[model samples]
Target: MLALLAAQLTLALLFGPASAQTTGAVKLATFKGPVTPVLAEYIERAIANAEVTGAAALVIELDTPGGSVDITKTLTQRMTSATVPVIVYVAPRGAHAGSAGTFITLAGHIAAMAPGSSIGAASPVGSEGGELPETLKTKETNILVADIKNLAARRGEKAVTWAAKAVSEAAAATADEALALGVIDVVADDVPDLLRQLDGRQVIVAGKEITLQLSDLPIETVPLSGIENFLNTLTNPALAAILLTIGLNAILFELSNPGGYVAGVIGVICLLLAFYALGTLNANWVGLGFVGLAFVLFVLDIKAPTHGVLTIGGIVSFVLGTFILFNTSELDVPWATIIALALATGGFFAFAIGKALAIQRRQPTTGLEGMIGQTAEVRRALEPVGTVLAEGELWAAESESGPIAVGERVVITGHDGFRLRVRKLTREA
Candidate 1:
């Protein structure tokens, strides 16, 4: 054992600096949008991947507005307990780590920021998506402030104070300001510069100290898998709303037409995706109810033929419903998308209703009912039971009053099984 240890020490002295810098690797993950459940899952997966690959560190490039508080808490826990160092880089010019992003940045094993980037706004919002009422807001703010303070304590007194202020007042600072205040360790221009600055930095991983040998190490950017990417995209509130509306329209069209499997299938799939997104977002149920009501009005208008009156009402309902569907500031559907969907929905139902009315006005072409009110010629004298030609087909006939002569013009009044009920027409003498 002593001999092996001596040999290893000799080799370390010979090639330590050069090999250490060149042999290290980094696993990079970029989060460029809101912090959703999908994002949290992605981070966890990326961290596991990095650990398995034996990478020196996992660097996350983050830029986000905000997202679910529960998801944010899960992410913070993951970051603090990661097997390897977690470096959170708030990147690029004009980018921000807002709300939940602030919590994540502060939780990093080694927090960093790129030039021009800012971080803050850790306030917790109400279920309605806006600022909580005074009492509830105070409670929520206190909870978040305490959480932030704990995360920032090791950084310094100034960082701890600023972190609490960020939760309470939504305070923000640029990269330079953050660095000066010890909110972040370093500010860099880009990833390469960040790695350069990160080389030889001491960080703790799972309670054990580790030094990052990041200089010139190869970086593998981990991206979301196909399914993850699709699910993550669904978390966009605007896209989810549009998808729901489109899905409903397709279902209604299929219901009105019947026998169209394609529309129904597509509608169901889209609705499933929309519902999944809504679940992740914790969307308001009352808003969903209003949207559902709008669709019901649209369907009613099509069935009852209301001369577009109900369609107009449907449009108003849909627009209003969409406006409130994601009432919270945290969950937003663009007004332009809502207006476009409302118009499209109204027009689609209006066309369907118009077609329904047209069908109602047309003469019946096929069915036993079509034979009624038709002029038929008596083939044989009807002694209450005889034969007649109607609709180009010979049919057994029954006379209503008296026997009818052959070639006499009769009006078909009704049908009883295969026999036609007829009334002879009297010619003026």
Candidate 2:
């Protein structure tokens, strides 16, 4: 009985769980634009989920101009440590993985590119835009070179040399060139083609050699959650700027039209999103101050009724602030967008304030104040107080002069509490 039990235990240990050994559907994640910390988090979650589900491989459809260096490092580490193969594919033609993207692409277990895609330019720069101080520049460049060299050494010597060149010279290559140079593994047309080419290919993952079994497997695309998608969109400099301007203006409009909840709610949400994006991008606070000052000027002009003086100053301040809002060359707020926003902002405030003034000058349309100058018919004789029909509703009306007969038309003069003060209308020569 002991011998039989020992044999059964050995068989079970050799086989283990079938699910853990067998690959499921291919897990896919499509990432585009500037890589961000949010994106890194998304990728991390994806890898965890893929591992849990026994995914055959995690295919990342990547297209980026680069992103945060720290986040890139985190992302690459996650990819390298993943239990399953991580394939980074620069896809859809005309796409190039530049800057931080180069590091991430090279770090993949199997790097690929669509026929028309390209990769390179792994240069690192300060999170704050522009050239760093000399000492800092050298230090950062050296650190990045060492990092890329380490990643490249896994691929081979030629790859290491090319990667070093990418860092030092911002070298780039087409898909064909990348494959030829051994910078990448494959060049295929699309995801399906990529899978076909990858089928039966042996690769080392998590320090163990494994052959891919990706043939005819279902592709499961992992998508960003609603909040993640929203936050990701906020990373765009143009979108962030537009959101900030619109949000401020909306809140200002809400103030101008007091007691309005819709504008205020939307404004607050947009502003919060803008602030979150700005924080992620490491925006200069001084620029924000200038933007705040611009809005203040606008509000002052609207309130004090300047002859466009403050508004003009506000426009200038807004343009200046927008130009300096973000501190990165990779992410620039377009001048066209800024100018358009400035003009639109000026026009929106002008129209909003103008309409507000016009409404203020106009007579009241509802409420106790609105009842004045409106005609009412006496429902019951108004000796002192009686019911009268005004605005299609009957109200208690007190005669201003003498008794008002029933069915006589009277003009509403004013109101106190629920009662309307009325005067009888008479023909005059």
The lDDT leader among the candidates is 2
Point out the worst 10-residue segment of candidate 2 by lDDT: 14-23
Residue by residue across 45-129, what tens digits does model 1's lDDT show?
9999987777788899999887888889989998898888899999878889999899999989989998888999777886546
The candidate that achieves the highest TM-score relative to the unseen native structure: 1
* Model 2 alpha-carbon drift over 4 Å, by segment: 1-22, 256-262, 284-290, 303-306, 327-330, 333-336, 352-429
lDDT of 2 at 5: 100
Candidate 1 TM-score versus the reference? 0.83
| Backbone steric clashes in candidate 2, count | 1
Q: Against the hidden reference, what TM-scores do the models get?
A: 0.83, 0.75
| Per-residue C-alpha lDDT of model 2 across residues 287-360, encoded as one tens digit per residue | 88989999998888766756478888989999998999876555779989999999999887677568767877
RMSD score of candidate 2 (Å): 7.8
Residue 1 of model 1 has an lDDT of 100
- Extract clashing residue pairs from model 2: 129-327
